[model samples]
Structures are given as C-alpha cells and as structure tokens.
Target: MDLAVLRPGELTGADREVWRALQSEARALGAPQLANPFLAPEFTLAVGRCRPGVRIAVVHEGAGPVAYLPFERTALGVGRAIGLGLSDAQGVVHRPGFHWDAQELIRACGLSVLEFDHLVEGQEPFGSRKFPVFGSPVVDVDRGFDAYLRQLRARSSKFVRTTFAKERKLGRDVAPVRFVHDERDPAVLRTLMRWKSAQYRRTGRSDRFAHPWIVRLMEQLFHTRTESFTGLLSVLYAGDRPVAAHFGLRSPSVLACWFPAYDPRFARFSPGLVLHLRMAEAAAADALAYLDLGRGAKDYKNSLKTRELTVHEGMVMRRHPVALGHVARRAPVRALRHAVLARPELSGPADRLLKRVGRLRTGR
Candidate 1:
C-alpha cells in the first residue's frame, strides 16, 4: 500500500475520483459518517475557513484507493478528525476487512497523537480509550410519526403522556403551533444565530455563532443537496413568529442533529423540546431510521433516549520525546475530565475551569 498526504487545496482530479470511489464503498458498507456529504471536499473547505488545519491522508493499494482519513493537525502534533466535537462519527474511511494498524496510520500522518471525540464504537484504530459514554437519543422514524408515538407510549407511557400534555399546554397558553420543514427563509437562520449566541452567553461559553465563516458555512450547507442527504432547516412558529429552530444534515436514513436553538422569550414553554418532537414527526414522514441527537449527557437527551451507544475520544501516543512530554502535561487534565465524568457533581466547576482556560487560550 502507498500513502499520500494532501493539503486542502492540493486535492486533484484523481484525488476527487478516489474520494468518490471510497464514498461509494462506504455507502455500500453502510458506514454512516464515512459516506456523509459533510465529509466531502467542498464541505471540508467550508469548515476549513473557520478551522484552518484540515487535511487528508489517502491510502492506496496498487492503484486503488483503500482508505481515507480526514483530519486536522493542531499545534504540538495533536491531530483530530475534521469536524470533531460536532461530527457524530469519526475515523478513517476504509474498505471492509482492510486492517491497517492504527500505529501505522499515525506514522503515515506523522502525527504524534491522533485524537477523536466521536469515534464509532468498534471502529477505533487505536483500540478503546477510557472515556465517558452518554446516551445519544435516537427516534426511529421509518414507520412515521404515529407509529413512533405508539412505540414511545408503549415503552414509556407516562413520559410520552406528560410531554404531549406539556405540548398541548404550550400551544393553548403560549402560542399556536406551526412547523416549517426545509424552510429556505434567511430570517429563520438569523433567528437561530441570535438564540444560539444568547444561549452560549448565558452559559458563559464562547459563542460559535460569532464566527463569520461558520455563519456562511451553515447558510451554504442549508441550500446544498445531494441524492442521499440534504441540509434541513426546521422552525417552529408561534403566531407566525419562529420561536424554535434546528439546522441539521439529513440523509434518507438519518438526521444528524446539529445546531438547535429556541427563543428565550418562550423558555417557559420549553420550545426546544417541543421543536424536537415536531422534528421527529417530520423525520418519520421522511422515512429516516434515526434522529442522531449528538453526544453529551443532558437531561433532555436522557428523557428521549430509548437506547445508548458508546463513543470515545483518546489517542495512542507515538514514542517521540516531545509527544510524551505533551501527553504527560495533558494527563492531569484528562484525569480531571475522567473524575468529573465519574462524579457528575464535579462537572460544574470543572466545566467552568475549562471554559475559562479556553477563553484564555482564544482570547474570546
């Protein structure tokens, strides 16, 4: 097998052909994120505008593409998959049964450590790294909303009944219910941005909406479509005014939940939760298999989750001295994270500290 390193703009016609070939194989193999349009070169270009280190490593076996790893190299030789944190799946796109060693891939990239936060279980090249597992709530939407609601009621009767009762109360007292799917309205996007920014500020976190490139990327993604997936913009309106909105990527089988926001004015009504129920209904009608509410342990995700899947983010460090030193210094931070994960009570202070550190680093 031969390996090649490619920069963002250096991808040639041959590279694109190889990428498409791998994507076709990924689709046939039912490897979800590997086949996603977000992994495409164009999408990566848009993400790279906000995150500049994105790159690709392609592996070939006798003139045929065998695997492709999309990654970003950060300072101090720390490499992570492109769109980490936000992407639900991570790792190389490899043909089935293609068993290249993880260490070999790390060497190929010349990376001291390759870390990922959303690596699909059993697909980690470096084997398992101890990390927290959070339930990613998924609503099976193939049989349509009625069928889904029936299953939900059967499994968790009280939960479903209460949410519905709340939904009714919201509509009756707060506002009239209205849903818009695949909405092309620019104003809806602006509303989402404002709400998301406010939410970040309230939480004392850096607002991703403040990035101009990210804003442009979402706008671009909303209009872009493919045979298997289309970017969806869903909004819940109250008396002709949008109060809750979600922007995400949807294929025929999955809705990869991304940015979701709701007007603070309607916080008492829990517009975000109401919006999710409506999103599920729309997804069911669209014949999706699952609504992938991305990782993180929130009470709402727990309320909606019927099952749990394990994902991880850790790395096998190369033996370079500098890399070892970096790992040693970062080990205490990793340990702190593990401690917080083990004891949820510690999360409040730990999260505040991490946010402060991030702000200090980014000057945000």
Candidate 2:
C-alpha cells in the first residue's frame, strides 16, 4: 500500500468521487453510521477551506484507492480529527479488511500525534487504544417516524406527553407553532448563531461561534447542498417569532445533529424539545434511517433515543518526544473525565459545578 497526504482542497474531483463511493460502500456493508455527513468528504473540504492545517491521507493498494483519513495538523505536529471539536464522527473511511500501520500513517502525514474524540467504532489500531467507550444516542427511524414515536411513547410516555403539551401551550400562549425543516433563510442562521453563543456562555462552555473560522465554516455549510451531504437548518417558530432551531448535516440515510439552541425567553415552553421532535419527523419523512444525536449525556437525548451507537476517543501516536509530551499533558484531564463518566454518581455533581461556574463566569 502507498500513502500520500494532501490538503483537503487538493483532493481531485476523482478523489472526491472515490471517497464518496468508499463511504457509500461502507454504509451499505452494514456500518450505517458511516452515512454520517460529518464523515463525508464535503465536510472535510469545507473545514479545509477555513482551516489551512486540514489534510487527508489517501492510501492506495495496487491500482485503486482503498482508504482515506481526514485530519487537521498544527505547525507543532499535533494532529486532530478533521473539524475536531465540531465533528462528531471521526476515523478512516476504508474498504473492508483494510489495515495500515498507525505509526507509518502518522509519519507520512508528518504528524507526531493524532487525536480523536469521537472515533467511530470498528476503527482498528486507534480503537484498540481508545479510552472507555461512550454511547452516542441515536433515534432509529428505519421503519418511519410513526414507528419511532410508538416506541418512544411506550418507553417514555410522560416525556412525550409533557413535551407535546408544552408545544401546544407555546402555540396557544405565544402564537401558532410552526416548523420549517430545511430553512434556507440566512437571517435565521444568524439568529441560531446568536442563540447558540449565548447558550454556550450561559452554560460555562466556550462559544464556538466566537471563532471566526467556525462562523465562516457554518456559513459555507449552510449554502452547501448535495445529494449525499447537505446542511439542514430546522426552525420552530411561534407565528413570526423563531423560538428554537437546529443546524445539522445530513446524508440520504443519516442526519448528524449538531448545533441546537432556543430563545431563552421561550425556555418555559421547552421549544428545544419541540424542535427536536419536529426534526426527527422531518428526518424520517426525508427517508433517513437514523438521527445521530452525537456523543453526550443529556436528558433530551436519553428521552428521545431508541438506542446508542458506540464511539471511541483516543490518540494514535508515533514513537516521538512530541507524542509523549502530548499524552502526558492530556492524560490527567482525560483520566478525570473517564472516571466521572464511569461513575454516574460523579456526573451530577460535575454538571452542577459547571453550571455554578457558568453562573459566576456570566455574572448571572
């Protein structure tokens, strides 16, 4: 096998087509999670447009391309999964039974360390090095949204009852509730960024929109539409006033839920939940099979998810000083996180502490 690394933008038209074909083959071969639009070449190109460090390693065996790994590399030789924090799915998209030396790939990419937070399952070498695996919540709508609703109702009837009740109350008290599944309006996208930024600050999290590149990336994706990978913006409105919105990426079979936020003034109405339900319905109607809620522990995800997909997090490092340094620097924090996640008892207190810190940070 021969490996070559190039900027995401440098991928030829043929390369992009081959990459998509590989992803499609993987999805068809029973790894439906490979359908995630985040893993699509378009997403890598989009991020590459904004981030100069973005590169892809293409491995060819004999006559054809067999594998592709998209990643971002810093000047200091630290590599990250493409789009890193923003991308929920990470790893190489390759043919069945393909394998490569992790260290060899790293050196070829000129990377000392390759880090991934949401590496999809079945990724060997890296999967072997993964920390405690985490379940990314998923809503399986293969049989359609109605079937999912029936299952959800059977599992969490009160949650469904209460959320829909809030939706009704919101429509009655504010205005008639309406939902737009694929909103094309740029103004609504701007509104979503504002709401999401405020939400981040309120929750003691770094605001992704504060970074110019991420903002630019979002704008680029909003206008990006293709058969296999398209940016979807769903908004829930009370008459003319938008209450909640979600901006995510979708392929033919899977919708990868990303940024979701709501107007705080409408919090009492639980507009976020209302928007999610509507999004799920729209996803099913679009013939999508799964709505990947991303790897996170949240009440809404728990209530709506029919099952969970396993995603790993870890690093692939070459034998180098920088690799050792990177691991040492990150180990403590990673260990603490794994410990907390392993013990449900630590999760609540950790979350409450973060919220309290957020209050202090925001002076609320």
Pairs in clash, predicted candidate 2: none
- Give the per-residue lDDT digits (tens) of candidate 1, residues 1-364: 4788787787777777666666556645767556545556556655665677888888888757777778888666778777775677667767777777878887888888877777765564567655445445566676778887787788788877777676677778867788888888888888898888877766667788787877887877787776655778999887788888999887656687889999877777777878888899888777666787877777777666556656676666788875687678777887776778778679877778766765665566
TM-scores of the candidates are 0.85, 0.96
User: What tens-digit string does per-residue lDDT give for candidate 2 at 33-139?
Assistant: 67679999999999989998999999999888888899999898999999888899998888888878888888888999999888988777664444568899999
Q: What TM-score does prediction 2 earn?
A: 0.96
TM-score leader = 2
Candidate models: Cα lDDT each: 0.74, 0.89
**Cα RMSD (angstroms) for every candidate in the order listed:** 4.0, 1.4
Clashes of each: 0, 0
Q: Global lDDT for candidate 1?
A: 0.74
* Candidate 1 ranges beyond 4 A from true positions: 12-42, 129-134, 348-364
